[model samples]
Target: MLTPLQKTTIRATVPALQAHGDTITRTFYARLFAAHPELLNVFNPANQQTGQQARSLAASVLAYAEHIDRPGLLAPMVQRIAHKHVSLDVQPQQYRVVGQHLLDAIAEVLGEAATPDILSAWAAAYDELAALMIDTERDLYHTGTEQPGGWSGFTPLRVTRLTPESSVITSLTLERPGGEALPPYQAGQYVSVKVKVPGDDHWHIRQYSLSAAPNGQQYRIAVKREDGGVVSTHLHDRVREGDDLLVHVPAGDFTLRAGTRPLVLLSGGVGVTPLLAMLHAALTDTPQRPVTFIHAAHNRAAHAFGPEVRALAAQHPQLRTLVFYTDVQDTDQLGLPSHQAGFITAATLKPALPLDADYYFCGPTGFMATVEGILDELGVPVTRRFTETFGPSQQFILPAAALAAPI
Candidate 1:
């Protein structure tokens, strides 16, 4: 617990953090990585390069200072990041290292503005926050280890098969090295896949959503080849069947919620990966469950899992599939899967989907915004709409109480 004076002092610095959040986070990461290069193994350099990681951290720091007195208000966001840290096997000691770098960064960035009293208050605040995170992560690690077929840290997995799903996306089936059963993950979870990119001495990690229904024998993930993406390029072009990869335990909170209403799965681009798993889980367990899969891609060349999902819909009477192509090609034709050309709008979807349905959506931020904008206009209850972003876990359309900022 923070003293009243300490809390007030910390609150006073919120404006500075919000104003220079990016600079502080940028300096923090630079210094932290310089001091401990080994942490590069756990962080994605691409996110750093694009400044997404820094911005995410900045948001969290600002949010923390904003809610220093009401720590419970940050529980949902804390839980989300805690799950992520546990997946990467983040230890308590690492918090100390991060704190040192963060404090130094603040001092460097703020200079004279960081008075001794303010620094002390921030130190106390950081310690308070870090203790909560470390304890929460400790509990998460315990839960993961206690689960059946679960193991701590990274598991050595062998690529059993690799199939090109589309021009850009490739599917990889990974199983335990000794052909042991892997733990069954929730439909919408993701696993961190670590590999050494060519010419990089340090290991790089990237999380790919489990793209298939868990069979217990193996886990499947799809990698979309990002141009110049260190990990994606390595996985897509360099990695092959029979190769070994280090995989973390599946961890994510963006999952299918318990509901009996019409289930709608909306995805854009490769964001369809996790939603596919959710779709499979529902259809496999309850064929009569009314579900809709509305996906949009650039063209037929970029569209993935069309045949497989169409076949599933064919087998299940209650399953509905809708696809849209932004830049339709000659190969793209009007069909059950490809419904129209252009983006998903309320006009197109409102008539096709049930307003009472539970909506699960993921995609590029713009696409998600479009979907959510429509859902909001339709007055979908916050409880009924679930979303999972494929990139960093940042913004979410959860209830007001579930989050404030740093969502």
Candidate 2:
């Protein structure tokens, strides 16, 4: 526990953190990576390139400062991050490296203005937060190991099947070397796939959601090829069937909640991967659960798993599948769109959805924002609404403290 004076000192730094948090975090990461190059294997370079990782770190630090006294507010976000850390097999030792560089970065950025009291208070805060994360990740790591067919670290799996789902997305099936049984993960969980870049000793690790139900035979992941993405490019062009790749145990907290409430699973573009798993899960586990699977894409040519969703909806009356084509193709639906013409908005969706339903949505930032607005306007309880973002998440924006930065 920090002393009252220390807490005050810590709270005082919040303004500077809010003003220059990204610069501090960017410098911290650069220094950390320069000191410990081996960690390049753990963090996603794509996130680094896009400044997502720095921004995420900056947000987390400011959020912690905002709610330092009432830590309960940070619990959910901490749990979510702990699962991600567990997927990368992150250890407690790494936190020390991060903490040291972070403090050094603040000192460098603030110059002579970073006082001893402020630095010490920030150090205490960092230690407190790191302890919480480390403990949570430790429990997560242990839980994954204790589960059936689970292992501690990276396990080698052979790519058994490769099939293109759309022009840009491909589904790859992975199985253990000798047809070994893999651990079963929750419907929306993901595994960290480590790829060996050509001529590089260090491997690039990327997490992909398991796009299929747990069948005990193989785990399937849908990967979308992105422009200038290292892991996606490697997986799309270099790797093929019969090739081997290292993967960590599946981990995530954005899972389907168990209840009798009607399920609304929505997706956009390639965000459909995890939601597709949840859809199949509802089919096998809860046959009576009413499900509405809505998806939005640029056009029919970009839609993945369209045939499967259509086939399921055709056979099952309880399952309703709706597709929205923002840019309709000439060959799509006899030169027409599917159900809707423009984006999936409140005007287009308000009539079909039940207010009491359990809503699970995954999509880009704009898509999630739109869904959040629609749900809010419909007066759906916060308890029933769940969402997860595809790329760098912008989900939780902490209540900002209005304070001006000092010179």
Off by over 4 Å in 2: 334-338, 395-407
lDDT of each: 0.86, 0.85
**Model 1: CA > 4 A from native:** 286-288, 335-338, 396-398, 401-407
Q: What is candidate 1's lDDT per residue for 345-371, written digit by digit as tens? A: 888888779658899999887898899
Report the CA-based lDDT of candidate 1 relative to the real structure: 0.86
lDDT measured at residue 116 in model 1 versus the true structure, 0 to 100: 92
Candidate 1 C-alpha error for residue 57, in Å:
0.8
TM-scores of the candidates in the order shown = 0.94, 0.93
- Cα deviation at 319, candidate 1, in Å, is 1.5
lDDT of 1 at 385: 80
